[model samples]
Target chain A: MDKPALAAWLGAEITGMALLSGGAIQQNWALDVLAGGQAQRWVLRTDAAATLAVSRSRAEEFHLLRAAHAAGVTVPEPLRLCTDRSVIGAPFFIMRRVDGLAAAHRVVRSETLAGGRQALVAALGRELARIHSIVPPRADLPFLGEPASDPCRRFVAAMRVLLDAGRLPRPMLEWGLRQLEISAPPPAATVLCHNDFRTGNYMATEAGISGILDWEFAAWGDPHEDIGWLCARCWRFGGPGEVGGVGPRAPFVAAYEAASGRRVDPARVAWWEIAAAIRWAVVAIDQAERHISGAEPSLELALTGHIVPELELDVMRAVMARAA
Target chain B: MSWDGHEAPDTRALLEIARTTLMEAVIPALTGDARFKALMVANAMAIARREDGPAAAAVHAAVRELGDVAALCAAIRAGAHDPGSADHDRIAASLRALAEARCRISAPKALG
Candidate 1:
C-alpha cells in the first residue's frame, strides 16, 4: 500500500498496517499510526482493481459521510480523503475505526449487545432518518446529479440497460422489471437514499450500533428505497427479523416516522423491495461476470452467481403474490 | 473426465468426492477467511455437480412452449405480456415455473 508515502502524507509514523477482509468492491486496510506521539487506529478504504459500475469514488463517499455525520447520523468519522492516485496507487479515504462486528448472522443473533433488538432497530431507523434528511442541491454532493423526477422508473430503465449489456438474457429479471415498470409509484420526497442499506453493513457492539457504514452507493431518491432495501427479505440473511434481519418492520417504521416527520408508506416500500431484489440480482451477475471473465478470479465472486436463482424466485414470488 | 468405466471418474463423481473431502476434512481444519473460502469452494463444487446433472425437462419445454428467452425478453420489454394482455397470466406462470426450475439447480432450498 506504499506505507512510506502514506506516512509521509499524514506526517505520521506507521505502527502497523494490514489488509482487512471484506468489501468486494473496495479494499480496506487496518491502519494504525502515531502522529504527534498520539496513537490512532483508522481504516483506509480504496478502490479495488475492479469495482461495481454503480459504486461512487472515494472522494464522493467521503462527502456523503461528511453530510451524514453533519446530519447527526452515527457513522465512522470520515477523517481525510486523498484523491491523488500516487498516494496509494488509487484514490483513498481514511476514517476513524469503530469497534464492533458487522456480520449479519451474528448481529441478528447477538445477546451480548445491550438495548436488545428493537432498540437497535430503532437506532437504525433514526440513523436512516438522519441520512434521508440530506436532500439535493447541496454544493458538497454535486456528483449526485439532478434528482430524478421518477426515481423508480429511472431505476428500471437503468437496470434494463445493464441487463441488456449482460452476456446472457435474464427473462426472469426482465419480467420483474416489467411488473415494476407498470406499477411505478408517484415520486415521493427526494432524499439521500442509501442504495446499499442492508444487513451486515453496520458495526454493532454491546452498547449498540457504533457506526453505519458503506455510503458509496448513496444517491438522491425516494427514502422508501432505503427502507425497502433494509427490510428486503433477501437481505434478511436467513434471519426472521423483518428489519435488517434484526427486528420487526413496525417498530422500525414507527421510529422512522417519528424521526423523519414523514408518514411511512407500506406500498412504496414493498415496491422498492422488489426493486431491491432485481438490483441485487443485477449486481450479483455483474460481480460474477468479473470472475467468469477472468478479471477477478475469486471463489467468493464465483459463488455469488449462485445467488441469482434465489433472487429470481423472490422476484417472481413477489410478482405473483401482488398480482391482481 | 470421460466415463470409460475404468473408474477415472466423470465430472460429477470427481466434484462430489472433491467437495466431500473439502467439506469433511479440509474445511474442518481451516480457520477464518481460509475456512470461508474453502466453504465457498465446496458450495461451488456442489453447484457444478448440480449443473452437470439433468436440468428440469419442464423448464426446457417451457422455453420451447413460450418463445425463446431472447424473444420472451424482447416480448416482455415490448409490453406483449403486460397486465390485461391475453397472454399475461400464461407468460407469468411460465416465468415462475422457469424460475423454480433454476432454483432447483442453483439453490433447491429456495424452492417452496
Candidate 2:
C-alpha cells in the first residue's frame, strides 16, 4: 500500500519510509510508525522487480518466520501478512526491524564483533539447531511438504531440473550432480534444514548473532545439510577460516552437536559441502541466465553469470579433494 | 574533412579511467546510499575493463580445444575421463588451466 494508506490501515501516522538494501528477491523498507503518541520502527518487505523462481512468496515467508519465532529461533517478529495485492500492488509483510549486520562480506571481516569468532560461530550453530528443532505436521506450518526418501537424490534431481529448464546443458554441474547421485548417502534423520544457512543469511552484532534471516529455502532434509552448507568454502567470502569464514569446522560441529544432541559424521559433512558448491554453481548460472535471456537486464546479473566458472572450479577442486 | 591527430581512448582505457574517477574522486565525496551505488558502479566498471582486456580472450582460447564448458563437462560426466583413467589427468589439467584463466580475469588475487 501507499505510505498514507498503510498508515491509515495501521492506525498510525507515517513518520518515515526508507528503502533498505540487500534483498535480491524482496524489497525491504524501514517504516517509522507513530501510533498513540508512541514511535515504532518496522520493516515492510515486498516483492522485487523480478523474483527468483525458487523464492517463497511473502505470505509463505511470513508463516515460516512466525513458526521459527515460536520455536525459539532468532528471527524478526512477523507482525502481519497482507496478501491482497490491491492493498500494496503486491503481497507484503511487516516485521520489527532488528539491529545487526547481515551483509556476508562485512560480517566475516568486521573486527567490531566482540567475544571473537568462537562465540559468534557457536551462537550460529546453536541457532541453526533450534531452527531444526521445528519438525513437520504442525498446524501452523502445513505448507512444509513431506520429507524426501533420499534427500540428496532429490536435491541433485532438482539441480538437474533447473539445468534442463535453462536449456543450456552445463557439464561440470552435471558431472558434480552425477557424482553426488552415485555417492548419495542413505537417508539420515530428517529435520527442518535451512537450505541456505550460510554466512550471508544471518544478522550479527558485536555481541553476537541477533537473528537468522531468509527462510525461503527451508526444507525437510538431513540436519547435517545445514551444517555442511554453513561451512562451505564458497560462503567463506575469501576468508582464511572455514565455519562460515569465522573458525574451524571442529568447534562449529561440536557446538551444533551440543545443542541438538546429534552426532555429526565428518565424512557426511564433507559430502554435503561438495553438494553446496554444486548447488551454488547452478544458482549462479541461473542468476546469470536471468540477464542473458532478457528476463532482467542487470550488470550485477551479467557479472554474476561470469562467476559460474569460479563455482565450477570449486566443484571440480572439491570432487578431486574428496577422491584424493 | 580534416581528421584530428589525437587518438581516442579505447574501451578498456575509458573504463579504467571511469573506475578510477569513481573510486578516487567521486567515491570519497559520496556517502551512504550514493557511496554504495558509486562503489557498485566502480566495481562494474573495473569488471568491464578486465572483461574488455585480452585476458578474457585468453580464457576462451585456453578452453577452445574443449569445444565448450558444457561439452567438456558432459565428457567428464559420461565417464570418458573417470578419476583413475589417463584421460582423467588430461581433462583435469585442462580444467585447471581453464580455471586459472578465469580467475586471472575475475579475481586475480584469488589465483595467488
Candidate 3:
C-alpha cells in the first residue's frame, strides 16, 4: 500500500516505513506516523503470501492482541484493525511498536542476557500464567475454536491425520504419537493456550520480556500444552537451559505456580514435550510441502523441513527418557 | 585433479566449493537477514554435497535393509514396534541411525 493512501486512511502523516523481517507467515511493517500532531511509531501486520492452515486472520489477531493487553499480558497495544482489503490489498492491523529483540539466535546466544535470563524466564512464566487465565466460553473471542475435550488425544489424532494425508511417511513421528496416545494423561483444566509459545515467539529486552507476539495459533487447550511447547527441545535454539533456552525450568514453573496458584505436573509436562516435538515436525513437513508443491517457494521453508530429523530424534530421546 | 571419463570438478566438489565460498566470502560481507539467508544457503549446499557423496549410499543401504520408511511407519503405527517389546529396541535403533544420517547431512553440529 502507498504511504499517501495509508496516511489518508489513518488521518496521519507517514514519516517513515520499513518492512521488518523474521516473520515467516506474516508481514510486519514499522511505520513512523505524525498523528494528532505528534510523532509515533506503529507496526502494521498483514498476511504473507501464504500462511499456515491454523493461523488467525488479521482481525482475529487484533482482537487477540487487545484481549491479551487487557489481561495484563505484555503485548503490543493494538490500535486499529482494517478489515477492508481495499486499503492495503489485504486486511491488516496497526499496533504500537515496542522496541526489543525477537531473534531466536540472538536471544539464545547473546552474552549480555546472562543476568536477565532468570528474570526473563520468571517474567515469561508469569505472563504465560496471565495468558492462561483468560478462560473461554465468552462472546468476545468467538474466533477461538472450541476447547479440545481431550488435548492429548486430539493432538494424537491431528498428527495421524497430518501424517496420513502427506505422501511422506514419518516412522519416528508415528511411533512417538503412538506412545503419546498410549500414555496420554487425563486432560487438565482448559484455558486460553498460546499454542505456539516458544523461544522465538516473544520479544525480550535486557530488562525483561517486552511483549509476547504471534497469536496466530492461539487455542483453548490444556495449560500444560503451552508450558511443554515453551520448554520443548526443538524450540530451544541450541541454548543450554530448558526454560525457553534461557534459564532452568524450576524458577519458571515456580513463578507460574505462584502466579496461577496451581501446581504443575513435571511428568505431564514431559509427555507434552514429546508431543510438541512431533507437532513441530508435522508443521515443518507442511512448510516444506508448501515449498515443494510450488505454493510458496521459500528456501527457509525447505530448510525448515530438514529439521524434522532432529525433531524426530528429540521425540525418541524424550520417549526413552520417560521409559527410563 | 585428473579426469578419466568424467569432469574433474564433480557436483559434490562444486557444492563444497559453493558452500565454502558463501560461508567465508558472502556471509562475512552481509549483515542481518541476508547473512542469515547466506548461512542457510551454505548449510543447504553442504547438505547437498554430503548427499551427493557417500551419505546417499549409506541411507540407501539402510533403507534396503529396513524396507521403505512408509512400510516401517505403517508397521510401527500398527503396533509392531510397541515400546518395550522385543522388536522395539531394533526399530528404535534403526530410526536413530536414520535420524543421525540425516542430521549428518543437514546439521552435523547438532550431532555433538
Which candidate has the top score in lDDT? 1
Q: Model 3, residue A261: displacement in angstroms?
A: 1.0
- Model 3 steric clash pairs: none
Looking at model 3, residue A175 earns an lDDT score of: 79
True contacts kept of 2: 0.38
Q: How many angstroms is residue A100 displaced in model 3 relative to the true structure, after the best TM-score fit? A: 0.7
lDDT of 1 by residue, B26-102 (tens): 99999998897887888888888888776656557666776778988999998888989998999888888888888
| CAPRI verdict (incorrect, acceptable, medium, high) for model 1 | high
Report the alpha-carbon TM-score of model 3 versus the true structure.
0.95
Q: Would you list the clashing residue pairs of candidate 2? A: A1-A88
Candidate 1 Cα outliers beyond 4 Å, as residue runs: A111-114, B1-8, B56-58
Alpha carbon lDDT at A4, candidate 2 = 65
Candidate 1 residue-wise lDDT, A96-145, digit = tens: 99998898888878645538888888888988999988887899999999
TM for candidate 1 is 0.95
Tens-digit lDDT string for candidate 3 (A1-324)? 677778889999999999986377899999999999999999999998777777899999899889899999999999999988778889999999988888887798765552467777888889999998899786789988688889899999989999999977787788799889889999889899888888888887777788899999988898999999999988888887797787888889989999988789988898889989999999889989989998788899989888887888888777877777
Chain A TM-score per candidate? 0.97, 0.96, 0.97
What is the per-residue lDDT of model 2 for residues B5-46, given as tens digits with 9 covering 90 to 100? Answer: 756787777888878877888889989878877776776677
